[model samples]
Target: MKEIVILGAGYAGLSALHVLQKSSADIHITLVDRNDYHYESTALHEVAAGTQSGEKISYPIMDVVNPKKTTFLQKTVEKINADEQSVLLTDGQSLNYDYLIVGLGFQSETFGIPGADVNALEMVDVKTAAKVYEHIEAQLKEYKTSKDEASLRIVVCGAGFTGIELVGSLVENTKHFAEIAGVKPEQIEIYNVEAADKILPMFSDKLGQYAINHFKKWGVKLMTGKMIKEVRPNEVVYQNGKDGDLESLHAKTIIWTTGVSGNKIVGESGFEERRGRVMVKPNLTDPTYDNVYILGDVAAVMDPASNRPYPTTAQIALKMGHYAGKDILNQMSGKASTPFSFKSLGSVASIGNTHALGLVGKAEMTAYPASVMKKVIADRSLLKTGGLKEVFAKGRFDFYH
Candidate 1:
């Protein structure tokens, strides 16, 4: 039997496994991951903001994987030896594969900023988000007696999708947290710092304006065109611009959602990578090694329409997984694989619990309808991954809130 090893149980890896399992061909599929549970990474921000529970964002790997055909190994990947077709696991075991799928996902990119890696709270995983939630709650509880405004000051780095969504959730939940802590809403301060001139730079001007307006109305301080110079336990230092003087913002909590790069293992494996991501061929396989496929945040594929690399999003990752599965099956069947052609499905971002912004096809949406669309997109993902049962168990059905 062919030994097919799939690494990392994120969106891409899991989707590939599901599609591959549908085939009747006899193959040994090993799904390896550091965590036994597959996490809804997109919902991690909600967990960090205390708007959702950790249990809601995660589900057991067995919930979706068919044990009869697939063997799930919970272990961390230490290295990938493409030349030998083997993967070194941290548990002192080595796994060999006839076909290898690397979807190891991402790591927080601090851009070499000092102290940012060590000090900033990242919204990368469920555990990290829970830590952030606990920290925020502890600070809120302490503020009840100490009345320290510093404890209430929150500085969120990056104004991209993840950063903005997190800021929105924090803004919406701050009122509720203050109420429970017997403090006024105005006592809380949230600063969204961005290096760009405006938030949501990749989006249309109207949508960006709408998000900016929402931040303004919600009392979220927008610090645009500010570059972070350093991060500290109690504050962050930033420069106004390229040649501007340095300034400082004191806060008890500093969230760094600035950026992400491919996991280091990809580069350490000796793949031609830029920014820790492998630039894969049109078929989503390594140019030199046809047996290895990369997807999600680890694979850098260019979009012919824009002549730029596709942004790392859950939607794109899901599509990549689907296509990668097909390609692998074709290879196994001795049929030529087709090139990957991505279709634009638009995008959505939650501004708050009840508010959101979206661009589906050519139409733009905001507020309640956008919020509903966001949840619909989320539910659709779960439905694809673990069927209707998973949707009912972990789906976001409370759209009106």
Candidate 2:
């Protein structure tokens, strides 16, 4: 039997596994990941804000994969030998594969910022989000006892999707946190510092303006066109572009949501990578290694319309995974695989539990209606991956909460 090995069980890898398992029984499939569970990466911001528990955002890998067809190996991938068609594991085992899928996800990009790497807290994964949540709670407790204003001050770096989502969640949880800590809600200081001239640069200006207004009404301090110079333990130093003056905020919590790059393993494996992403052919296969497929954050696929690489998001990754599986099956059947194409349904960003901003097709929405749409999208994702059972168990049904 041919050995088909899939590395990393993120959205892309898991989606590929689902498709491949039902496609053919001629090959043996092995799914490898460091963790036994598949994390709902899109909801990591909620995890960091204590709005959702880690358990709520993740499910066992076995729950979604059929053991009869797929062998699940929980281990770390040490290295990939593309020429040899082998993958070395940290447990000192090397596995050979007839077909390989690389879906190893993203890593935080610090851009060589001073003290940002070591000092700022990251919201990249479940573990880091949990840490941030715990730290926030601890600081609240400390502030309650000592009344230290610095303990309540939080400076969030970046004004993009993740950063905005996190700040929105923080806004939602502030009242609860204040109640628990026996402090006034006004005691909490949340500042969103962005180096760009405006937030959500990827979205339309009208949508961006709506978010800005919502934040202003919600008491989130927006510091635009400010470059973060350094992140200290008790303070964040930044330079304002308007005045060219250095300013500082007394913040004990600095959450860095600035940027992300493809997994380093792509470049380390001797593949041609731009920004750590392997440029894949139209069929989502590596140019040098036809049997090797890269998807999600690790694969750089260009958009035909824009003539630029598509942004790495859960939505795009899901579609890529679906296409990658079909292409692999076609290759195995001695048929030419079709080029991958993506149709974007839309995009939505939740401001809080009760509010959101979205652009679906040409239609734009805000507040409660947008919030409902956000929940619908999340529920639909769970339905796609894990079916009705998983949806009932882990789906977001509380649209208003």
lDDT of 2 by residue, 1-401 (tens): 77889998988898888899887558888999999998988899999999999999888889988877889999999889999999999999999999999999998998988889888999888999999999889988888788888888888999998899999999989998787668889878889999999898768888889889988988999999999998877778899896798988888789999989998888888899977799899989999999999999999999888898988888888888888888888888899988899877778988777788878776988788889999899888777677788789998777655
> By TM-score, how accurate is candidate 1?
0.98
The number of clashing residue pairs in model 2 is 0
- Residues 55-122 of candidate 1 have per-residue lDDT tens digits of 98788988878887899999999999999999999989999999899999988999999999988899
Consecutive 10-residue window with the lowest summed lDDT within model 2? 381-390
RMSD of each: 1.2, 1.3
Model 1 misplaced stretches (Cα beyond 4 Å): none
lDDT of each: 0.89, 0.88
